[model samples]
Target: MFKNLKNDLPASIVVFFVALPLCLGISVASGAEPITGLIAGIVGGIIVGAASGSKIGVSGPAAGLAVIVATAIGNLGYENFLVAVVLAGVFQIILGVFKAGIIGYYFPSSVIKGMLTGIGIVIILKEIPYFFGIDKNPEGDFAFLQVDGENTLTELLKVINALISGNFDYGATIIAVIAMAILLLWGNVLSKKGKFFQLVQGPLVAVVIGIVYYFLTKDSGLELSKDHLVSVPIPDGLSGLKDLLTFPDFSALTNPKIYITAFTIGLVASLETLLCVEATDKLDPNKNVTPTNRELFAQGSGNIVSGLIGGLPVTQVIVRSSANIQSGGKSKASAVIHGFFLLISIVTIPTVLNLIPLSVLAAILFIVGYKLAKPSTFKAMYDSGWMQFVPFITTIVGIVFIDLLWGIGLGLAVGIFIVLYKSFGNSHFLHKEGENVDDGKIKMTLAEEVTFFNKASILKELDQLPENSFLELDVRKTRYLDNDIIEILEDFAFKARERNIDIKLISERGIIENPDSFIEFFKLKKPTE
Candidate 1:
């Protein structure tokens, strides 16, 4: 894991810069103490990262679960919620043991692309307001509709109004612009000039500049307030940090609601983890495929540890994982190191950490967002044809307007419909136009598997047979014919007689002349092996 220390160490710094605000913001959004999110990040990074088979995928408290976490906390109390989170970990471990992680492999590649693209768009949109210091919502809340009563679109509209009225923070906007400029220069030019630039990393530089700017502008008209900065809870010492940690209530074991909440958390967290593993694999430069079951087990163990210490539920989040990959992380060591950073920084230098401006982080995320949702990616998907493009576009729209899971569900539904439509048209093949011209003969070969969905197309073909025609029905290649299709053929046999059609049934069993009933014929002839 430490083999790529040069790469992983720098990348870990970038991920730490990216993850710190997210940890605090998601915790606040989830209605938990800010320290709880940090704990989850620590566990997810150190514990899950060490156990996970994925080299680049990063796990932490997820934005997708904010609503569930908040609701659980409100309904059951924080202590009971911690109990639910612990149970949720147990459930995830059970799922991993049962090999339920394979469920992620079934998602179409187009949908996965859509997921990455959609998240990129969300990150850009959500971070825009932060860049200008219009920070009403938490940084990690990625849902379309935010907890602040405004949707993503509406929030942008608010930002525009704030800009027009000159009601925004000039200090934050100035810092964000400078940070973005530094990132662009460092990434596009400076990083290529020498190894030192790559080793330092643009994000870490931007953050340092932002902190310096914060101190320089203090008490001035352009000064940024606490709302525009990273917020980590400061503790007196090791004992004070320990006092902040809350343990799960074992007394809640008898509560049925706790189990229900646990199930929900487990199911959602596992799904998110699996999806992330798939996406992360796609993002890997080496094209490494993570063992999904191992990822689930790692996530389960992380959640268990997190909950035991009063932390939020954890999932493999795309934002952090993508950031890690974009920052050139090469192994799990990066994730583990970032966890150590979070642990050490909050303990030793939290006040200084809080001095970093949120706008600068927003600037860093803007780059991450652009990388994921590049305009070229859209054109490439469009050129891939509708079978791929439709689902891909639909998922992006669904994610932008709805939530993550709902967007995937909508895309899956569209993809399935397209598959069925294609299947309906491809049920069987007819002989060449000029073949069997004598005797008005027509040959039809059934597909490998004919289901009820193909009944209409088959029926139409049979009804179009000319009077006095010779029909050669071929099932030599068919493996399974649905009862509906068999019934259709049986009904068509009676019509064939009226049309004076001579039917020749062909199968592995034998050929028959004018077979009486398709149902009986199929029953007598077993399907080919």
Candidate 2:
């Protein structure tokens, strides 16, 4: 990993700028102290990044978990909630040990893509208001309906109304517009100039310019207040930083609600981490696969440490991961370095960080969001067929209209339904060679894998056979035949005898004549073997 520091160091710096604001925003949105988010970011980067098998995935406090964390904190109180988070980490470790990471494989590719796209749409929706200088909701709230009594679409409308009525903050709007322009130009042009330009990053430049703009407009009507800027808790000194950390309350372990909350956090965090691992692998230029089980273990460890030290739950977040990838991260070192940046920044220059505008960060996120949910992505998925497109579209709709988990659930349901439908129709193929039923010449070719899903179709075909029919049952191509199908064929053989039907079973082991039982005949050992 150290071999690629030339690339990794620069990528780490870019990810640091991207992660800093998000850490602060997510903490405030989660109903936790802002410092807690920074702690999670620090641990997720240094601990989880070092421990994780993934080379490119970046873990942090995710906007996806903001709702769950907020609700849990409100119910259990901060200290009690920290206990739940720690227990959740324990549960995740257990899951990793049991190899439950295999659950990640069960999700269809279409649904996964839909998830990325859905999250992109959510980010764009959530950030648009901020970009336009409308800041009613907190920065990291990414749900369809926010805790502030405004939904995604309604919030967009409110931004439009505010703009029309001239109630928006001009300082934020001007800075945000200029920052976005700088980012676009840097990405499209200046970044190509040299390694130095690439390493510096457009977002950092945008932020610096935004701060300067803020200072320049201090006494003007276009001035932005502290509320419109990044708000990391600034300590008076190194000693004051110690007061920000809050440990979990062990006494809450006896509460049943704590157990429920733990399970919820563990399940959600594991799922989010697994999905992120999959997406990150897709984004990796090297196409290296991350060990899903090991990732769970790493995240579990990070969360445990984070909780003990008063941090929100951590997961492999796609936003930060994507930023790392886009910034040319070559290894896990980039993620680890980003964490150190978070730690050092909070310890050293937090007061300076406070001067950065939220609008500048929103512009950066807008670019990230747009890239994830690009129009090209939709077109590509649509071209893949309805089998792929339906689940993909369903996931997007569900996520936009409902919540993240619900959207994924709905997409998975649709994907499963499609698989079942195809299975039912593809059980077997029937071919009739002879014209007359009296002659009774029929051939039934079984599918490569015949399952219980094909039971009804096979049974119906058997019942339709004419009396005194000659039937050929072909299983030469079959690799697996379900017990249900075997039983159906067995019962049909008995009925065939009563109808004076002659049966010949042809398989890989040659032919069976008047088999007493389909199961026994198929299971019989071959002489050559």
Worst 10 residues of 2 by lDDT: 520-529
Steric clash count of candidate 1:
0
Please give, for residues 434-500, the per-residue lDDT of candidate 1 as tens digits.
Answer: 3365769888888776654453456557767889889888888777664446656776787788789
Candidate 2: list runs displaced more than 4 Å.
Answer: 425-529
Question: What lDDT is reached at residue 508 by model 2?
Answer: 79
TM-score of model number 2: 0.80
lDDT string for model 2 (231-274, tens) is 77777677887788999999998999999999999999999899
Model 1: lowest-lDDT 10 consecutive positions:
426-435
lDDT scores for all predictions? 0.85, 0.84
Inter-residue clash pairs, candidate 2 = 440-470
Cα shift from native, residue 271, model 2 (Å): 1.1
Q: RMSD for each model, in Å, please?
A: 14.0, 13.8
Native-to-model Cα distance after best TM-score fit, residue 507 in candidate 1, in Å = 28
